[model samples]
Target: MARIRIDLPEHFAFSTTITLLLSHINYGNHLDNAQLLGVVSEARLRFLKSMGYSELDVEGVGIIVADAALQYRSEAFHGETMKVEMSATEFHDFGCDLVWRMSEAGSGREVARGKTGIVFFDYRSRSKVTVPAGFRGHFA
Candidate 1:
């Protein structure tokens, strides 16, 4: 199998902290692999909210996760606070990639790095839509 390597940007536009809960732990006593996405989802929401947007409304268009990839660096335990840093990149006509890195808050021990591909969507029309100009302008 090929290892996934994510080259993070020099700087992140947004960051938030989340403490792992007991529910986030798996049988092996670390952060559950599946729950990692949940953590990222929370960070993504915070990133958008800081810009006055939501998964259901980004400059008049909703966003759907088209794909996701993760590269785990280390295990995380409950009660550990994670600092999640995120940035938007890889823009296309209708979508972009939201890349992020997670690390232990104080120790700076990396936990994971990943990207989520998001495509603009129109819920009323139930169709894909073009990326909003205002949204793109924010990144520019």
Candidate 2:
């Protein structure tokens, strides 16, 4: 068996805080694995919104998550405020990886970290498209 490791960037370009709800907890009384990804998804939306874009419209194309990887570090309990930080990295012709980290808001205890590989797509044409220069420029 092997463990997944996520190497985070030194500085994140965007961040947001989300508080865990009872529904986010599982029978273990901590954050559920699946819910953690949900949290990340919310953070992703915030990151894009900050850049004045959305998953459905980045420049002229939409984005689809091609894959995802996560490394869990600690249990997160309900009512805990999580500080999620995100940055774009691993750029390619069509897209890039949105890397992020999640930690307890005040304690700074890392709960999880991961990256989602996103690919730009022309929904109407039903095909992948090259990354938008305008979108890439924000991170450059």
Candidate 3:
């Protein structure tokens, strides 16, 4: 099987630091693969909030993640602070790709690279919607 490859962007527009907790570790005593995604989700939320939006409400239209990919580069242990950086890219008519890079805080050692494809939607109509103008203007 071929693994997904993600090439990180040159610059990240936003970043947040999160500590890996004991619960984030697996039996192997390192950051679990599944929990890493949750950490990234938290970073995404912080990024959206900084822009005055949320996962369920971005400029009047909500968003749903259509796809996601992650490439883990190094192990993360409990009690370590990770710096998660995020950026928006690959814009389409109705959605965009959110890129992420995770590394050891202060050390700059890369831990992972990832991307999530998200599409705007109207919760009331239960249909996919176009990207909001305000959202694009602010983040694009």
Model 1 lDDT vs. the true structure?
A: 0.96
Number of backbone clashes in candidate 2: 0
Error of model 3, residue 31, in angstroms: 0.5
The lDDT values for all models are: 0.96, 0.96, 0.93
Instruction: Give the residue spans of candidate 3 off by over 4 A.
Output: none
Over all chains combined, what TM-score does candidate 1 have? 0.98
Candidate 2's C-alpha runs over 4 A off are none
Per-residue lDDT of model 2, residues 21-133, tens digit only: 99999999999999999999999999999999999999978999999999999999999999999999999999999999999999999999999999999999999999999
lDDT of 1 by residue, 98-131 (tens): 9999999999999999999999999999999999
Give the CA lDDT, 0 to 100, for residue 28 in model 1.
98
Number of clashes in every candidate structure? Answer: 0, 0, 0
lDDT of 2: 0.96
- In model 2, what lDDT does residue 49 have? 94
Residue 109, candidate 2: how far off, in angstroms?
A: 0.4
- Candidates 2 and 3, the one with greater lDDT: 2
Error of 1 at 14 (Å): 0.2
* lDDT for 2 (candidate 1): 91
Window of ten residues with lowest summed lDDT in model 1 = 131-140
